[model samples]
Target: MTNITFKNNPITLLGEQVTVGSVAPDFSVLANDLSVRTLADYEGKKKLISVVPSIDTGVCDQQTRKFNEEASKIENAVVLTISNDLPFAQSRWCAASGLDNVVTLSDHKDLSFGMNYGVVIEEMRLLARSVFVLNENNEVVYVEYVNEGTDHPNYDKAIEALKSI
Candidate 1:
């Protein structure tokens, strides 16, 4: 139940909030190809999971693109951008934006990633803007549930954490 807001209006989020040093939770989300992907899919690699409300929005676009650009510089890691958008829409957006680094995943089918990661916005059925970095052992090294849903995440901090892992 992290406190956050959308456009300055307070909103409720569902599910248990994760914390640093905890075992990272596993979730099922749809890849751009409509295939199911889970945390295990990226085992043995440091991961930076970037959660956004929707991929079509302006801030979301910037967030995803930022991580996508940083992905190549990150060694032994993967950049994942999770959103509530449909797989079709996610694919479309990725293709249109020509983004190849970050892997876009969708939680629209069952909100698996949204609820498991505690980023689900109860009022809007969309994920709040958040960033998580996990070590190779799947332990959370950094977690940021952005205080404001529409704002950019602390990219420098997240990247630093990822690099430290």
Candidate 2:
């Protein structure tokens, strides 16, 4: 039960919270094409999993854009922006932003990623703002469950963790 907040109101989260050194949980999500994507999709590559409640929000927009910019310069790595938004909306947002580097995934259908990562906001049915870095072996190298749902994650630390792997 990871305790977080949205607009100063305490929010409950579902599932077990992952920690550094733990094996990253496998989950299924939908890509922009509506195809199922899972952890195996990026096997043997570093994964930067950026979780957000919704992509259309101001903080989410910035987080995705920032990760997109960073993803382009990274090699053998995949930056994924996961949200509960529909695949259509995720595709549209990526296109409108011209952010082609980061992959936008939708977990609205099953909430697999949300529940596995323990970022699901029980009250609002949204994922809390969080970031996770996984090594090639699917081991979590870094995890940040933002205390405030609207605050920005420690971008530098997450990127450094990915680079360190």
Candidate 3:
């Protein structure tokens, strides 16, 4: 288990964290259409998993929008904004915010995405703020586990890493 803190308070995650150079765990997340989507669905594309606590929060919403804007400039890449929110809510937020480039995925059903990625908050029904960049071959190339739960992530670094792949 990985030890992380929420708002400076310590919390324990449920599973082993995915590391750079390791193969990302496969997950069946709920798409906006309520259809199940797996890792294979993004084959041959660089994947950016922007795992956040929820889009309802200000920081999370900003991150999704920022990534959505960056997604258009990044060629052959899929930016997935993942959270524990329901598919309907995710879709609504995206549509309202005009977030067309990024895909918001939900892990409300099985909760395997958070467990497998080691970002699930133990007590709360939310995910830790994290980012994982994967190559077209499905190998993890970059990872960031935000130490402070409330702060925004370093998008510049993540974008730099994605551009390298």
Candidate 4:
């Protein structure tokens, strides 16, 4: 588990911390159409998963947009913006923002991804800010659990790690 903060208030994150070199855990998350999605759905593609508490917040919005822009440049990579926000809200936000490059998924149904990735915020029932990169084999190449939920993740480092893997 990892200790993180929302604003400056400390909170506990549930589940095991994901370490580099481990196989990325598979999880069920919902797409905008309410269809279930998992790692298998992406098959052999490299992945960048951006876990955010909610899509409505400013930081989450910026993070999603930044990744979406980057997704355009990366070949054969899928950028997933995962959140606990409702599917309706996630779809609305993506449509409103014109985000087509990155897929926004909802973990509200079961918190499957949140729990499996050990990013669940115990008190808030939301996800702590985190970024993960998985190579084609689904091995974790990079993992970043932002100590502060409201702060931005190390985007450059994550991308560099992705390139290396």
Q: What is candidate 3's TM-score against the reference? A: 0.95
lDDT of 4 by residue, 43-72 (tens): 899899999999999999999998778766
Tell me how far the alpha carbon of residue 14 in candidate 1 is from the true structure, in angstroms, after superposition.
Answer: 0.2
lDDT of each: 0.91, 0.90, 0.87, 0.90
For 100-155, candidate 2 gives per-residue lDDT tens digits of 66699999999999999888889988889999999999999999999989899999
TM-score, candidate number 1: 0.97
Model 3 lDDT per residue over 45-120, tens place: 9988999898989999999888768866889998999999999999889788865666999998988899899888
RMSD of 4: 1.1
Tens-digit lDDT string for candidate 1 (1-165): 446999999999988789999999899999988999999999999999999999999999999898778766888999899999998999999889987656999999999988888888999999999999999999999999999988899999998999888
Clashes of 3: 0
Structure candidate 3, residue pairs in collision: none
Clash pairs for candidate 1: none
Q: Higher lDDT: candidate 1 or 3?
A: 1
Task: Name the lDDT of candidate 4.
Answer: 0.90
Candidate 2, residue 26: the lDDT equals 94
